[model samples]
Target: MTPRWYEEGEEPDYRFTLANERTFLAWLRTALALLAGAVALAQLVPAFSVAGVRTGLAVLLAVTGTVLAAFSYRRWAQVQRAMRHGRPLPMTWLPFVVGVVAALAGVAVVVVVLLHTR
Candidate 1:
């Protein structure tokens, strides 16, 4: 008997696999939007506060977006592997990470605006 390529596991349903791909694409789109937003904010937005504030905001958002994209890839792979192996999905920290970074960016923006006002 010949061992199949999926000999280590079984093939999951096509619907599930396709759904996963769609989700990955969605995350990629979100990453692209964030990156675009960063560029627009940095280059287009007038300086509401001190110089570099917009750039800092853009950098933070860009970093968050990059992290989300990386995590999304890792999570999708892990999920697919887990499904193939019939293993439980792994927990992830992406949401908390994004939230914390977003909060920090908001605080930075507030501070910058305040500084500009004074």
Candidate 2:
């Protein structure tokens, strides 16, 4: 089946297109923030009992953010292509994984702070 955009030779709304671009940039910015936070935590924290583990996790988060940033454009392109070609857009798993990791990280941070404060 032809895509709604191309089936009848309909042009995409420019306003919506611009909005999509803005949203993609926002995602990239969020990824950057996550990367910075991870790097700072890993590097600034002193060596302690769980320091190594926290540092390792922080590195992982930074890498994940980097990957997400790199892939953001690619994913946006895929969605655009799908819209233009009337094909299903590729599914994304990064967001779900990121969410889960963020939740776990929050729990870890709480545990660390509680222990440190006592």
Candidate 3:
């Protein structure tokens, strides 16, 4: 069944629709990378000095990736709707959130390594 929104708006330009699809694909790629990182971290990396820190970071990455992957489709739909309706594009904070989370993870990795080093 088609979504109500999909039925509401006229079809948007093919180019714009394709661009939105590409953007969605890019987000999925990022999500896949994050998920892969989580798996690699949990399986390949040695345990941190602090108990559960490694697991915690891995879970964080996995959750972030899951959320991003789920939301990317919503975002793509939104952009398509906006284009179809001739409305202004919607704004998003996803990039900022991803950046902050990634930065925090990087810092945590560094701190853990430093603290654990002999």
Candidate 4:
């Protein structure tokens, strides 16, 4: 069944709709990559000097990916709705949140590698 919001807004331009879909797909791809990274870290990477650090990082990635994947659809719908209503696109915190988390994860990985190499 179509979502009620889908019917509420006037039909947006085809190009805009397609673009929104593409954006959504891109988010999905990122989510998939994160999930893959999580699995790789969990299974392929050696244990860190600090016990549970690797597992914690892996869990963090998995959770981030899951949340991003789940929210991408909602974001897409929100954009679509805004376009249909001729309103300004809504601002989102997702990118900022993702960036901070990713950066932290990268830093954690670097720290782990450095500590492991010692």
Candidate 5:
């Protein structure tokens, strides 16, 4: 059996552990929101003149949500490991990647609108 994280390292304070859990939950909530938003956008928005734009945007959002959900667990584990080992928490790159995804979605929307109008 794989060794448990708590087995190898000292237990950190309860408050920090709880905080890490809360952060994980927050990311889960964000992922859910992104999924919901994508669904709503896909259904509620009228068909654009440019084919596949809405679908592409929706797919991108869904993928971003999936990535965030997956990465959040890894980040939480890393933070937990650090806390348990008395090491400084590692810097995360997810936020930057998420930002880039959001930016790309925005640009896609703009391009679709402009293309439809042209």
Candidate 6:
């Protein structure tokens, strides 16, 4: 009988397998980096009256970063599984990411301007 596609007698698609693994690893690394940045922001702000805004922004960033990190692996896994099953890839989160980054940037700009004008 002809061997199944995934059987030992059949040659597996090494390139596809390797590419999926690499993509997953890249996403994981990105998640870790984001979480680390958030931790740094949350830790480095000092305690002061006017520091509240900074603290808030830092906290927001930390939370967003955490969310991104948490979602990265799950999304990656979903995509990998979809690819294996020959299904459509999951929709990209680029729009949400862009919106969040833009909002964060706006907040950061306001904070910086306020600090500078003081």
Q: What is the lDDT of every predicted structure here?
A: 0.80, 0.74, 0.91, 0.92, 0.88, 0.63
TM-score quality measure for candidate 3: 0.90
Q: Which stretches in model 3 have alpha-carbon errors above 4 Å?
A: none
What is the RMSD, in Å, between candidate 6 and the native fold over all Cα? 5.9
Ranking by lDDT: 4, 3, 5, 1, 2, 6
> How many angstroms is residue 37 displaced in model 5 relative to the true structure, after the best TM-score fit?
1.6
Instruction: Report the alpha-carbon TM-score of model 4 versus the true structure.
Output: 0.93
Per-residue lDDT over 33-72 for candidate 1, one digit per residue giving the tens place of the 0 to 100 score: 8788888888898987577778888998898788888889
Residue 21 error, candidate 4, Å: 0.2
What would the per-residue lDDT of candidate 6 be over residues 1-118, giving only the tens digit for each residue? Answer: 6323333332336686677678767666755665676576568745434546656666666666666667776776665566656767789684488367658757775777787677
lDDT of 3 by residue, 1-118 (tens): 7778887767888998899999999999999999999999999999889899899999999999999999998999889889988899999878887898899899998988898886
Which residue segments of model 4 deviate by more than 4 Å? Answer: none
lDDT of each residue in 32-82, candidate 2, tens digit only: 988988877778866545556688668778977888899888777656666
Give the TM-score comparing model 6 with the true structure, all chains together: 0.63
Return the top candidate by lDDT.
Answer: 4
Model 2 C-alpha lDDT versus the unseen true structure: 0.74
Off by over 4 Å in 2: 1-10, 86-90
Q: Which ten residues in a row have the lowest lDDT in candidate 1?
A: 1-10
Task: Name the runs in model 5 displaced over 4 angstroms.
Answer: 1-3, 114-118
TM-scores of all predicted structures: 0.78, 0.76, 0.90, 0.93, 0.85, 0.63
